[model samples]
Structures are given as C-alpha cells and as structure tokens.
Target: MVIFGCVGIIAGCGSLGLWLANRIRRRPVELREFLMALSLLDTEIVWGATPLPEAFGILKERTDAPWQGFFADLQDRLQRGESASIAWNDVSLAQNSHFCLKHEDWQVIRDVSKGLGRSDRQEQHKQLELIQRQLALIKDQAGIWSEKQAKMWSYLGFLCGIAGVLILI
Candidate 1:
C-alpha cells in the first residue's frame, strides 16, 4: 500500500510539474505580441509632434492586454529621456522579443537624434513587416509545442490510469 501511494504521489507531482513548465514556457509568446503592438504604436506616432511620453502613455492606456509590466518598464525607461533606439533595444531583450533594430532603422533614428532631418519613412513599414514575420514564426512554434504537449499529457494520463488500475488490482 505504501509503495502504491508513493508511486501515485510521485506521478501526480511530475504531472503537475510538467503542466506548470508548459504554462511558463508560454510567456515568451505573450512578450512577443506585446512588443509587436508597441512597435506599431511607435511607428504611428513617429511623425507626430506629440511628446514621446504622452504618446507612450496613451498607447499604454489604450493597450487592452496584460502587458502592464512590459509597458511600465518601457515607460520608465522612456521617462528617463533615453533615446527611442536605446529604449527599443531594451524592450527587445524581453522573452519572445525577436526584434533587432536593423542597421538602416538604427542609422535613421540615430541621425535624427543627432539633429539630422528625419530619414525617409520607408523603414517603418519594413520593420513592421519583420515584426509580423516574427509573430507568425512564434505562433507556429507555439502551435507545435501545444500539440506536442497535448499528445504527451494524453500519454502520461493514460499510463497513470493504467498504473492506478494495476495498483488497485
């Protein structure tokens, strides 16, 4: 009886641990989505005369998702008067954030910061395209991972059920 109980306990704990791990692994996906949306917002506001803080604040408030932590971090960094490029780099470090500012975009932002006229607006669309691609890639990976998890958990549950039956027998 003790042996059966021990086995059951261990299996239960293992199953729970696996489930938790799967849940935690999904954070990166959410992070990427938040970054994508934030980037798009930045693009839309780039040509506006609105102060970065005010624009960012409005975007943050309007964002209807569980990204307060991410947005707050970005807002804090921006409030420090950090350059947009640098702020973007920081934001890109979050999990699921696969974006890296292209050299062209970086050059454009940097030149503008140094008092050069705003570079052409072409790069914003390119960057948005890149973000879309990244989102699609992450979505694909998440789908595969979830499918695999479903199969794995099904097998695990089946085995656990069989084991329990053997124990009761």
Candidate 2:
C-alpha cells in the first residue's frame, strides 16, 4: 500500500510538470500558426475580396483548435453584426482566450482591428501589411521565448515532483 501510494504521488507530480512544460512549448507554435491564419486572411481579402464572415469561415477551416475556435468565434461575432474591433476585442481577448499572446501582440491586433473595413481597399491593404509586420515580430519573439522556457518548465516540473516525493519519504 505504501509503495503504491508513493508511486502515484510521484507520477502525478511528473505528469503535472510535463503538462505545464508542453503548454509552454506549444505557445510559440500556436502564435506562428496564428500568424499564418492572419496572412491567409490577408490573401483572401486582398485577392478574393471575401467579406469578414466568409474570410473568417475560411480561416476556421484552415486552422486547428484553440485557434480554430478563435476564428469560429470571430465568424459568429461578425454574423451577429459586431464591428471588427469589438468582435476582435470580445472574442480574441475575452472569449476562447486559451491563446497566451503577449499584451503588445493583442494591442497591435486590436489597434488594427478597429480600422478593418472602415477605409478604402488600398488603405485597408496598407493597414494589413503593417499588422503583418508587427505580427511577424511577435512570432519571432515567441519562438525565441519558447525555446528558452519550454525545457526549463518541463524539467522544473519533473524535478519538483521528485522533490515532493523525497519530502514525503
């Protein structure tokens, strides 16, 4: 009974650590994929002239969850007649926000979301290009940060679990 209890405790701790580490590891990849989705949106808008709801619907198809969920939520909001800025703010930041974007990233997007369809086509293109550049920088930073933190978090969790077992013993 005692041996089984100890094994369970250690395993639980290690699993927790691994889960935390995996979350840290995946964040950068999520951001990168999000950038791709945004770029795809740019393409559909610039070339296809697809409206928000349709463009977002295309994005939802291209992406995976929680990102897929983000785009779907956006589609829903747009269908509900929410403005681009409000939909983005409410959906991206408030709802389905498992995405761990930095505040600056959100600000960059939120700022651009405000002007989404208000301007002429050429102006909207320029705004999108600018947003693309900002998102690129964010993607790069996320990659760097994730590389640094992911392994550390994982090992830290595993070690903490072992330490917990040791303390118990």
Candidate 3:
C-alpha cells in the first residue's frame, strides 16, 4: 500500500505537469484562432463595407468556443446601444477561469477594443493591421514557450515527485 501510494503520487505529479503544459500550449492556439476571427471581421469592415454592429451580427463562423459566447455578448451589448469599447470590455473572455490568456493577451484585446469602430475606415484598417501584427508576435512567443518550457515543466515535476518519494521512503 505504501509503495502504491508513492507511485500514485509520482504519476499524479507528472500528469499535473503535463496538464499545465497543455494549458500553456492551448493559449497560443486560442489566441491565433481569435486573431483569425478578428481578421475576418476586418475583412467584413473593409471589403464588405459593413457597420460594426452589423458586421458582428453577420459573423457566423466562430472558430472556437468562448469566442462565440464573447461575440454573442458583444452583439447583445451593441444591441443595447453600448459603445464598441464598452461592449468589448463587458464581454471579456479573459475573466473566464478555463481561459488560458495572460495579462498581455488581455491587454492586446483591450487595446484593440478601445478604438474599434471609433475611427474612419482607413484608420480602422491601419489600427487592426497593427493589432494583427502584435498578436502574431505574441503568438510566436507563446509557441516558443510551449515548445521549450512545457517539457521542462513536465520533467521537473517528475523529478521532483521522485525526489519527494525517495525522501519519504
């Protein structure tokens, strides 16, 4: 029973590490998909010549989960006559416990929201393009962190677990 308990502890620790690493990996993918959705919105604005509220209403293809909820909330807020910035702020996906976004990610979204639909078409395009560039850079950084740190976190957890078991024994 003692040996089995120790083995369970080790396995649990290792699995916990892997789970955390998965969370780390997930952030970038989510952010990238979010960016793609934003780009689609940008296309609607620039090419389709749609207004902000209508553009949001027209977007049916959400690439991920919370984003659909986020946008739905946003549209609802807009329908209530709240400004774009307020609506975006109100529909914060970052506040979700299951979401893997960092403060930086939240900052990016917040910054993007602040000017959304407030500027002229040309200026909006420029602003969104800049946001896209920033998001791409952050996504790259997250990819690197996932690649390098995830293994480290898993290995370190396993080693730490083993060390703890040995010490206990």
Candidate 4:
C-alpha cells in the first residue's frame, strides 16, 4: 500500500511537471500563431482593403483554435455594431485566461485594437508592423525560456516526487 502510494505520488508530480513544461512550450507556438494571424490581417486590411468584420471572418477561417474562436467572437461582435476597439478589448478580457501569453504580451495585444478601425490604412499598417515586431521579439524570448525551463520543470517535478516519497518513508 505504501509503495503504491509512493508510485501514485511520483506519477502525479511528474504529470504536473510535464503539464507545466507543456504550458511553457505552448507560449512560443501560440505567439507565432498570433504573428501569423496579424500578418494575414495586415494583408487583408492594407492590400485587399477588406473591412474589419470581413477581415476577421477570413482570419477566423484561416487560423486554428483559440485564434479561430477569438476571430469568430470578434467578427460576431463587429457584425452586431460593436466598434473594433470595444470588441477587441472585450474578447481579450473575456478570453485572457484561455491563452498562455504573459502580461506584456497581453498589453501589446490590447494595444492592437486602439487604432484598428479608427486609423487610416498606412497608420494601421504601421501599427500592425510594430506589434508584429514586438511579438516576434517576445516569441524569441519565450522560445529561449521554454527551452531552458521546460526540462528543468520536468526534472524538478520527478525529483520533488522522490523527495516526498523519501520523507514519507
């Protein structure tokens, strides 16, 4: 019974560590997705001259989960006569916990909607380009951090499990 308990404890700790590591790993990937989505939005707005709602619809169709959900919600809100800024803020606030982004990342994302539909095409393009550059920097940092920390978290969890078992024994 004690052995079984120890094994269970170890497994649980290991799983938790893996979960943390996975979350860390997902940060960069999600950021990259965001960048891609932003690029597409830039194309739609600048070159194609597509309006915000239809642009979001295209984004919704092009992206995957989380982003797809975000764009879908934003598109819905825009169609319902909500301004782009308000809808963006609303969606960001409502779905904040669903993402693995950091506070700075969220801040940048929130800043995106400020000049969105209100600005001219050149201004909007510049804004998106700036945001993309910032996100790219963040993605690079996150990728480096994840590479260093994920393994540490995974190992630490197993080590903690062993320590706990030792204490119990």
Return the top candidate by lDDT. 4
Order of quality (lDDT): 4, 3, 2, 1
Candidate that would win on TM-score: 4
Residue-wise lDDT of candidate 1 within 38-74, one digit each (tens)? Answer: 4655465555645556656766776645454445556
Better of 1 and 3 by TM-score: 3
RMSD of each: 7.4, 1.8, 1.8, 0.7
Which clashing pairs does model 4 show?
none
lDDT: worst 10-residue window of model 4: 95-104
**CA lDDT of each prediction against the hidden true structure:** 0.53, 0.79, 0.81, 0.94
Local accuracy of candidate 2 as per-residue lDDT tens digits, 3-112:
88777877887788778777767767776787788788888888889998999999999999888988898999999998877788788677436866667767776766
Candidate 4: segments with Cα more than 4 A from true spot: none
Model 2 spans with C-alpha error above 4 angstroms: none
Q: Which residue runs does candidate 3 get wrong by more than 4 Å?
A: 58-60, 93-96
> Residue 165 of candidate 3: its Cα lDDT?
94
On residues 130-159, what C-alpha lDDT tens digit does candidate 3 reach at each position?
A: 999999999999988887887888887788
Descending-TM-score candidate ranking: 4, 3, 2, 1
TM per prediction: 0.55, 0.88, 0.90, 0.98
Encode model 4's per-residue lDDT on 76-162: one tens digit a residue.
999999999999999999988888888888999999998899989999999999999999999999999998999999998899999
Superposed by TM-score, candidate 4 places the C-alpha of residue 2 at a distance from the truth, in angstroms, of 1.3
**The 10-residue segment with the lowest total lDDT in model 3:** 57-66
TM-score of 4: 0.98
